[model samples]
Target: MAPNPGRLDVGAALSYGFDKFKANAGPWLGITAIVWAVGVAVFIFTFASTLTAAIAAADRGESAAVATTSGVFIVVTAFGTFVSYFVNAAFVRGALDETGGPEKPAFGRFFQLTNVPQIAVLALIWTVLTVVLSFIPFLGTLLTIVFGFLLSFSLTFLLDRNEQAVTAIKSSFDLTVKNFGPLVLLLLALAAINIVGGLLCGLGLLVTIPVSVVAINYAYRVLTGAPVSPAR
Candidate 1:
């Protein structure tokens, strides 16, 4: 629990994640896949509505109206992204807790946890930082990558464990600074899984989501010696 200097053991992390997926692949995948599908549908619906409003404003030759509409669209989009991030974090933490043998998994309860105000604030800060970093040149890309890993680590630590938000964020940052190489690899692996899963018409999401969740959860446990809870 001394911060898993070996956490960068990519093969071990992948294997542990796959093992967890194998154990509860059926139920986890089924639940997560459906949730993801619904999310995609909602996104499409929102986008269509926003686009229609924008076009209507433009047609009216009202520049101010168009600008206001665009602003609203951006705000709505940001809010949706914020909610999605927290919900996903909540689900991953809930799933990890169940698989790590501390609690029984309750999908409904996990979704409900997303309503927590702190999670929204965390998500908003994360989104703003990501957006700002993305606008930078080459250094921006590098910063974004590093920041992303840290953010993921912090979120996992915060949601899955019982640490206060400030403490979790500080600990995650410290761990990332100490193990930058391994943490980078872990982030890359998770990214690859997501890219591939998304490409497979989302069919691969069933496997990828659960596996990635377990892997990150294990990484947190190894790094922090935090007790994993059973499902709530």
Candidate 2:
């Protein structure tokens, strides 16, 4: 498919995403379920004992033990979140195919787990750089937000555009600057949707998460001029 020359429309993209979610709820939810199940299992396996000890140490006013446990937790959580970026690419691709492609893509597309090493390495680079920049007080906050928005589409671009991880990161920042305002609106809207999902005892995520993926991929398609069918 050829890319479209027009820009993204935030509301229209989100509405299209919700529609796709309604149509493909089962498969999307299945993907979410599997991801969460594995995440929870890994968390338990890695941190269950440390977490218990941390809690006990906190009750005993043991600052050293608490700090150690907290630091370990942060590292583990960062690694998990890094891996999730790759997992999220699968969801983005599936959502793109569902909303705009002529035929359905495989439901387990996210689990294909290709390019994992590249994904992880890029993720680590971003994390370390961001963590350092995040320490600069007000300027740090501003830079983080700007880079956050700039790099937001990196994973989707990597998956959909067949770009290398570093190339995708660079492309995301470049394209995002061209359409900064609309993409920021889209990002805020997705964040709001996820906040609502979080409020619904976390079950709303089964719907909102995939919808967010669809919305971002839709923006990626429009901004990059990727060929896609009109959203129903």
Candidate 3:
């Protein structure tokens, strides 16, 4: 039988994601919310502190010092973002595995996975590509959107494959390139949710985060030709 080649069903994807959330809403939401809360608090504190430091440096007429401090803040934030990506991937995978399937990954195992050098290298490469792409004018903006989608999809793939991080990253790029349209729509949906989440002082994120995890899982399954189980 010929497979359906139409647009990927956004409605079906959203429904699947919602069902997955309903199945294990309590534990998954509780844990994720708490972790996100703490993460946000820490991020705000750091951001405020850095801003104050820059202001003080500027007040002292030390523009060079302010620039140096701003640079350091950027680097720290970038590093933190990279690390958080792995942590979120680990959490989503663990939560889904625990609630939706038989195997339960141990808490903090995702952090342990980051200890492998390949993971860091993969993250660095992904980061560099994203930055370089952002430099072009109109095309750069379009590429950024496309690249962002591929990047998210790729990260989920890497997390699921359990291969060396570099290999996983390569696989993600390959899968995304091969399935561009559907993946782009999926990524756009996620980005919309994130923007809404941000607008609501992050409360909307409670809904978006879990939905994203499931969506990424769906994307991964699609790319790998895995069986899609009914939502529990």
Clashing residue pairs in all predictions, respectively, total: 5, 4, 0
Identify the candidate with maximal TM-score: 2
Q: What is the full ranking by lDDT, best candidate first?
A: 2, 1, 3
As a whole number from 0 to 100, the lDDT of residue 231 in candidate 2 is 61
lDDT score, candidate 3: 0.64
Candidate 2 all-Cα RMSD: 3.3
Question: Which order, best to worst by TM-score?
Answer: 2, 1, 3
lDDT of 1 by residue, 1-232 (tens): 3432333467777677787677555667666876777688769867886787777777667886678676766666666667677657766656556556544555554554532555666777877776666557899889976676776666666665655556667877888787778767887888898889989997787788887777777666655555543322
lDDT of 2 by residue, 85-181 (tens): 6666667668667756786656766566556666776688777766677558899888888887888888776766667879989998898999989
TM-score of each: 0.78, 0.82, 0.75
On the 0 to 100 scale, the lDDT of residue 144 in model 3 is 73
**What would the per-residue lDDT of candidate 3 be over residues 50-116, giving only the tens digit for each residue?**
7776776776678766786767566656666566665565665653464335533344433344334
In order, the Cα lDDT scores of the candidates are 0.68, 0.77, 0.64
TM-score of 2: 0.82
- In model 1, how large is the Cα lDDT of residue 71? 71
**Top-lDDT candidate index:** 2
